[model samples]
Target chain A: MRGAILHAPGDVRFETRDDPEIIDNTDAIIRMSATCVCGSDLWDYRGINPVSEPAPIGHEYVGVVEAVGSEVTTIRPGQFVIGSFFASDGTCPHCQAGYQTSCQHREFVGAGGAQAEALRVPLADGTLVATPEIPSDELLPSLLAASDVLGTGWYAAVAAGVQPGSTVAVVGDGAVGLLGVLAAKQLGAERIIAMSRHEPRQRLAREFGASDIVTERGDEGVARIMDLTRGVGADAVLECVGTPESMQQALRSTRPGGGVGIVGVPHGVSIDGEQLFYSHVRVQGGPAPVRRFLPELVELILNGEINPGKVFDLDLPLSEVAEGYAAMDERRAIKTLLRP
Target chain B: MRGAILHAPGDVRFETRDDPEIIDNTDAIIRMSATCVCGSDLWDYRGINPVSEPAPIGHEYVGVVEAVGSEVTTIRPGQFVIGSFFASDGTCPHCQAGYQTSCQHREFVGAGGAQAEALRVPLADGTLVATPEIPSDELLPSLLAASDVLGTGWYAAVAAGVQPGSTVAVVGDGAVGLLGVLAAKQLGAERIIAMSRHEPRQRLAREFGASDIVTERGDEGVARIMDLTRGVGADAVLECVGTPESMQQALRSTRPGGGVGIVGVPHGVSIDGEQLFYSHVRVQGGPAPVRRFLPELVELILNGEINPGKVFDLDLPLSEVAEGYAAMDERRAIKTLLRP
Candidate 1:
């Protein structure tokens, strides 16, 4: 087997690796059908997140189960399935509350790296949700997206409280933010403002149901959103970029009594308690509990209700995984889909 | 008119002042029936919130409408009224959204000093909620409590998403926190944990419907709450204290996907974004939108469904307003009620 490993900044290598196998009774090994480069992956690829040692990297995938541990139930070999980056024991109190990412018995499924020919997923019965059938080739990308980005964007919109007649603002131009625009639209938001500086991303955002696009950043972006909303600010704002400035913009662009759903992993963000208190805004963010929405999102994708696969602008063979990483890191691709 | 003024830390003086008069078209002058010392006042009294000069103090009151400006409507002279500390034009978008405290056309109603014999309340038609009829003397304290503390506590519980059978933890034991216990109970929270070290406040909390009391602070307090909830943490946590420690305690005490409602006017609180991001807890805070809850709270008090006034443990005439402040500052009283 081969997989992508990050050895240092600007260095991703696709090299031979040991084949994945069931490590526990709850584990299942899946032969990867599709995988992709994630925006979060760039965190380590850029050295912003230190790489103390070479490690397998990707965490998003859709695959066919190749084998299952003796105790694995519900998920069987020969089925096509998707799972979140985090493997959760679905019966935990946190998982029961629909926050599988915070489950008491959780494991980072990315530890074995989904960028490989095959990967081992723990708590298989709880983590993986199989499609009704093996999805067609054209539906592959969207199904893979259900493993992370699409579900994440959906969670962001739901967490932001986007509802019928809601005015929503998304503060990032990445795949997640664009999908957030789609999610908000699906959730019945009446108006969606996408803040983006890139032409291609802006176009995709508009196609994904962004009613307006603001080619500005920081304070200027907030002002534009406020101006567009007639100074009341949006009913919900999605913070898809994990920087302090992006978070602030998202927070400030929301109306009093509105919500800000942050899906970005904060790098160096600190919120002043007084400012938040006085803003009268509600904030909820975390690693998206993608598992909670996997079934519905998979259904939506299969029914052709959504086309999240549009986010994959670049595709390559799994052997060219390093190039895929470079394409996304260099802004040459919104996201890269790799066929394994 | 006479009012209490803070000239410096620990220096509250009762002295003659100009009579409050209607200044805005929406203004109404009210003759104070009762005003109380608030925990927030101690911030200034303790010099934590700097006092630049001698300023009229107090923001909570139950009073009789004495006069109204030419354009004032809805409220009539001689009506017994209860209003929030922040006056709001009821027609503003924020007010319509039930966040009157964040209303665009907001005014600090306490500018004229609610501790005085007379107060000029702006946005009279919006801010003041009149009782069904002139209440007997006994209901004065409860009505006054609705002006701020009770309303704040109620907002905390409401914002924290308290629902039937919820496990709620209140992180403060002052007047507002004590009343938060009452609010949680009224909201149908099955298990209420009141954090307090003071025996008197603890007793009051139990009376207010605290099912359990944890006499610990900071980390230990969080541990106690976690232990009580079988390590799952409370479903909703009310943060009625404005300090960073209290905020952290409240955040730490909530289970994933739960909520923390904060009503305290934060002085020096900052939330670490990464910590909050990973916690999967929703946090919403601000000055209580007391005006939104005024009518309902007033009815509850009038019907004797709740008795929040029990927080006022000491009483004094307007002339001894200084002693009232001193007693609250010295912790001799949970709260002090002043009569004019």
Candidate 2:
């Protein structure tokens, strides 16, 4: 099998590796059908996040089950499936509460790696959501997104309480944020303000249903949102950037009694309790429970309700995985799809 | 008129003050029937929060309306009324959205000095809720409690998303926290856990419907809560303590996807975003919009559905107001009510 590994900062290598097998009774091996580069991956690639050792690095995948362990009952070989970044036992108290990311028995897929020809998935019955039929090439990208980004964006909208007539503001123009715009639109937000300085991403945001755009950042961004909403601020805000400034902007851009759903991985972020308390802005989100939304999102994609796959602007063969990482790191691609 | 003024730390003196009158068109003059010391007032009284100058300091009050400005129509003279610490126009977007504390036209009642013999309440028509009728001595305390502590506690329960059959935990042993125990019980929470070491307060908590009590503080407190909830934590937690430790315990004590409603006035508290993000605890709350709940709460008190005024364990004459602050400060009284 060929897999991508991060040996150190700014280093990604595609090399031959032993094929994965079902090691645990609840495990299953999947032949990767598609995978993609994520904004989070850039953290390790840019060396901002120290790389301690060489390890498999992708966690999103839409693949076909190649084999299953003796204990697996629900999922079988030859089925196309989308799985969450973290595997969760469906029976845990947290999982039952629709917060699978915090499940008592949860496992991250980073160790197994999605950017590989084949991968082993633990708790296959609980983690994998199987598609009803073989999907067309046109539908594959969207299903692949349902594995992480799209579901995450959907979770952000839900967490922010984007209601039918809500005015939403999205912070960050990454694939996830743009997808959040789409999610807010689908959820019936009357107006969506997307904050993005980049022209290309701004266009993508508009296509995903942004009613307005604020190219400014920091305090200026909050000013723009307040100006747009007649000094009241947006009713719901989606925070897709985890920086301290972005977090503040998101909090400041929301109206009193509104909510800010943060999906970005926080990096050295600290929020003042006094400001948050006085603002009355609710906050709720974590590593999205993608598994919880897979069923509905899969249906939405099958019905052509959303075109989130447009976020993938670059595609490359599995052997050229380094170029895929480089394209995203260099900001040349919004998201890069890898064919295994 | 006479009022209680904090000339300096630990120095509260009852002194003569100019009589309050209906200065604004929307203002109403109220002859004080009762006022009480608050937890937040302790910040200035204990010298933890610096007092810039000598000023009359008290905000919670329930009194008889003595006169009204030309613009005031809904409320009449001789009516018994209760108003929040903050006066609001009630027509602002925030007020309409049930966040009257953040109303566009809002004024702090601290300047009017509820502790004085007379108070001029701005936004009289919006800020004050008139009782159905003059109450007996037994009912005056409960109606007065509805002015601040009870309303604040009810908001905490609502913000925490307390529901039928839900498990709730209150983090403070103060008046607000004890009232929160009562609010949780009234809101149909199946189990209420009160964190308090004080025997009298614990008795009050149990009477207010606390099913369990945890006396430990900080990390040990979190551990005890986790132990009680089968290591999963409660479904809703009311954060009545504003310290970083109390805030973290509130977050840690709530189950994943659960909410923590913080009503305590925060002082020098900062929360790490990364910890909050990964914990999957939802947080929402600010200064309670007591005016929003006035209608139902007024009815509840009139019918004796609750008795939140029991939190006030000491009574003081207007001249002995110094003892009122001392009682709460020295932990000799849970709360002190003052009569003019």
Candidate 3:
């Protein structure tokens, strides 16, 4: 088998690797049909997150089950499935509460790396949700998105308390942020303001149902949101960028008694308790419990109610994995879809 | 008129001052029936919050309307009323959304000092909630409690998402925290855990509906809460202490997908963004939208359904204001009620 491995900063290589196998009775081997470069992956690729040694990359995938261990039930070989970055036991208290990412017996699915031709997924019955059928080639990208970005964006919107008639603001313009605009719209938000400086991303944001666009950053962005919402601020704000500035913008852009949903992987962010206390805003965020939303998101994708796959602007063969990383790193692609 | 003034840390004096009068068309002058020393007041008395100059102190009070400005409506001069520390225009968007503390046209009711015989209240119709009738002296203390502490505690429980059968933990055992236990009980929480080291406060907490008392502080406190909940953590946590330690304890005590409602005025508290992000806990805190809950709280107090005023273990005349501050500052009294 071959997979993408990060040897060091800016060094992703498509190299031969040991084939994935079922090591536990609850595990299953997946023959991946598609995988992609994630915005989070750029952390290690840019040396912001130290890559101590060569390691497999990628956590998002749409695949067909190649084999299942003896104890696995409800999921079988030949089935097409989408799973979250974290494999959770569906029966755990946290999982039952819809926080699968915090499941007591959870495992990071990216440990073996979904960027490979095949991958091992633990807690198969709990982690993977099968599609109604093997999806069409055109539906592949959207199904792949449900594995992470789409689910994450949807979680961000839900966590922000977006509802019918809510005025929403998204603090990042990345793939997840653009999808967040889509999620807010699906949640019936009456207005969505996307903060972006890029031309192409702005166009995609508008297409994804952003009612307004603000090309500012930091205080200016918050001020623009307040201005647009008649100085009351948005009812909900989605924080898709994990920086201190973006978090502050999201917090400040929400109306009193409103919510700020954070989906970004925080880097060096710190919040002043006093400021948060006085803001009268509710905040809830974490690694998206993608598993909780997978089934519904898959249904929506298959039914053509949503087209989250539009985030994939650059598609390439799996062998060109390094090029995919570079494209996203250089801002040449919103997201890169790689065919296995 | 004479009122309590903080000349400096530990220096409180009952001195003569100009009588309060209606300053705005929406203002009303109230002859105070009762005022109490709050845990928050000790911050200034202890010098944790600096007293730049001699300033009128006190923000909790229940009183009789002495006079009403020309434009005041819905309230009469002879009515008994309870008001929050912050006066808000009920017509503001934030107020309409049940976050009156963040009302755009807000006034600090404490600025003129609530400890005096007469105090001016801004946005009279928006800020003051009249009782059904003028009650006997026995109801004064309870009505005063609703003006701040009880309302704050109720807001904490509500913000923490307390619901039927919820397991709730309170992080402070002051008047507010003790009442938070009562609030949790009123909200139908099945288990109320009060965190306190003081025996007297602990007894009051139990009396207020705390099913369990944990004397641990900091990390040990969180560990005990987890142990009590069988390692799953409480469904809701009330943070009634503003220190960083208390905030951390509240956050760590809540289960993933749970809520932490904070009411304490935060001091020098900074939360690590990554820690909060991974916790999967929803946090909502502020000064508390007390005005939003005033009516219901007053009704509850009047009906004898709750006795939050029991927090005032020490009672004194208005002239002995200095002793009231000292008793609370030295922890000799849970709270002090001052009569005019």
Candidate 4:
């Protein structure tokens, strides 16, 4: 089996590796049918995040279970399923409370490597949600998105407390941001503001039910949002970009007593506590517990109520995983889908 | 009229000042019956905060309405009332949303120099909440507590999302922190953890409803909270101290998905975005909208449901205003009340 590995920053290679095997009573091996490069992957590719070892590259996937251990009672061989970015026991106190990312026995699937032909997933019974049957080829991309990006965007919206007739503002234009617009729309938001200067992404945002578009940066962006909201600011803000500037903009774009739901992976950023405290804003964000929303997102995708797969702009064979990384890093592709 | 004046960091003098009169159509002149020294007042006294000009020092008070402007129809002379540290118009969008401290036309009563014989309160119709009748001498201290400390503590508990059977931790043991224990208990918190090192304050905290007292500082404090909760941490943490250490401890003491309601006036604090992001905690704080909870706090005090006034340990005449400030600064009293 061949898998994508990062030799170092800016270098992705696909090489032969031994096929993964069931290592524990709760383990199962999945034959990957589809996978993709996430926005977070660009961090390592761009060398913004150091890659000390030749690490596995992707975390989002939809596949067919090839083998399962005796302890895996809910899933069996040959069944189609979607796995979350974070593998949760799904029955811990935290997971049961809908915080699978903080699950007591949680594991980051891709940290050990997920961009491979056959991937071994632990906690199979609680981590993988099996679909009714094999999904159609056209449904694969959307179902795969339900594993991470779509569910994360949905979590961001839910954390921001978006409700019927809410006015929402999204701070980033990445795939996750686009999905956030879709989620806010699905949650019955009356107005969705997308902040983007990129034309292609703006088109997708509009397609995803954005009510307005603002091409401003920092203070200018906040001004645009305030103007759109009659100076009261948006009822909720989705902070999809984790930079200090983006977070500050998100904080500034929300009205006092409003909420800012953050889903971006925060880098080394510091916020003035005095400003945050006086803002009278409620902030809730962390790693999205994608598993918490996976089942529902899977159902929504299968029903055709949403088309999150529209974020994928490039597709390639697993052998060319390097090109997928390059294209995404170069902004030539919003997302890359790999066929194994 | 004699008022408390801070001429410099270490120089608080009792001096004569012009009697205040209604300056706006919505203003009212109140003859203060009682006022108290706040922990925040020590910020300037200790030279941690600057005292640029001679400023009036007290922000907490309860009194009788001496005069009312033409536009003040809701409140009239002879009515006994309790008001917040800040006077709010109470008609702004923020006020309507229950964050009156961030009200667009809000005015800090302390900055207006309320530690005087008579003070002019702005937005009288919305700022002053009248009691059924004149509170007796026994109820004066409690009603005065409702003016700021008790109200702020109540806001902290409410913001922390305290539930009937939840565990809560308070990270300050000043008058406000001690009152937070009272507030948490009133909200039905099952176990109240008060972080304090002072013997007197700790005893008061337990009396006020602290089920546990941990004198540990910094990381050790976090360890104690985790140990108490079997490693998960408290469901809620109320940050009554504004220092960076207190903020960090508050964040660390709360479990993932819990709340941290901070009312401390953040001075030189800076928060690491990534740290807070990974915590998956909800935070809401600022200049507490004490006015929003003033009505309820007054009712609670009047009904004898709580004794937050017990935080005051010294009583002095209005002419001895300097002594009141000195007593709190010297740690000779938890709080000093001045009768005008």
lDDT of 2 by residue, A69-164 (tens): 898889999999989999988889999999999989899976888899988999999899888987888898899988899999999999999999
The parts of candidate 1 lying over 4 Å away from their true place are none
RMSD of 4: 1.4
For model 4, chain A alone compared with the true chain A gives a TM-score of 0.98
Give the alpha carbon lDDT tens digit for every residue of B243-273 in model 3: 9999999999999999999998899999899
Q: lDDT tens string, model 1, A1-340?
A: 8889888989899999999877899999999999999999999999999999999989999999999999888999999999999999999999999999998999999988989889999999989999878889999999988889998898999999999999999999999999999999999999999999999999999999999999887788888888998899999999999999999999999999999999999999999999999999999999999999998888999999999999999999999988999999989999999997
lDDT of 2 by residue, B216-287 (tens): 988899999999999999999999978888898899999999999999988888888998899998999899
Model 4 per-residue lDDT tens digits across residues A1-340: 8899888988999988778888888988899999989999888888899888877778988899999988989999999999888888988877877888888899888864678888888899889999999989999999988888898889889988899999999999998999999999999999999999999999999999999999998889999999999888888899998888899999999988888999998887787889989998888899998888888898998898899999998989988999998898888888899998
Over the stretch B205-230, how does candidate 4's per-residue lDDT look in tens digits? Answer: 99999999999989899999999998
Docking level of model 3: high
Q: Candidate 3: what lDDT?
A: 0.94
Interface Cα RMSD in Å, per prediction: 0.5, 0.6, 0.5, 1.0
lDDT of 1 by residue, B1-340 (tens): 8898989999999999999877788899999999988899899889999899999989998889999999887999999999999999999899999999999999998777889899999999999999878999999999999999999999999999999999999999999999999999999999999999899999999999999999988888888998999999999999998898899999999999999999878878999999999999999999999998989999999999999999999989988988888888778899999999
Q: What TM-score goes with each of the models?
A: 0.99, 0.99, 0.99, 0.98
Chain A TM per prediction: 0.99, 0.99, 0.99, 0.98
By summed lDDT, the worst window of 10 consecutive residues in model 4 chain B runs over: B108-117
lDDT of 1 at A173: 90
Q: After superposition, how far is residue B58 of candidate 2 from its true place, in Å?
A: 0.5
Q: Lowest-lDDT window of 10 residues in candidate 4 chain A? A: A107-116
TM accuracy, model 1 = 0.99
> Which of 1 and 4 is the better model by DockQ?
1
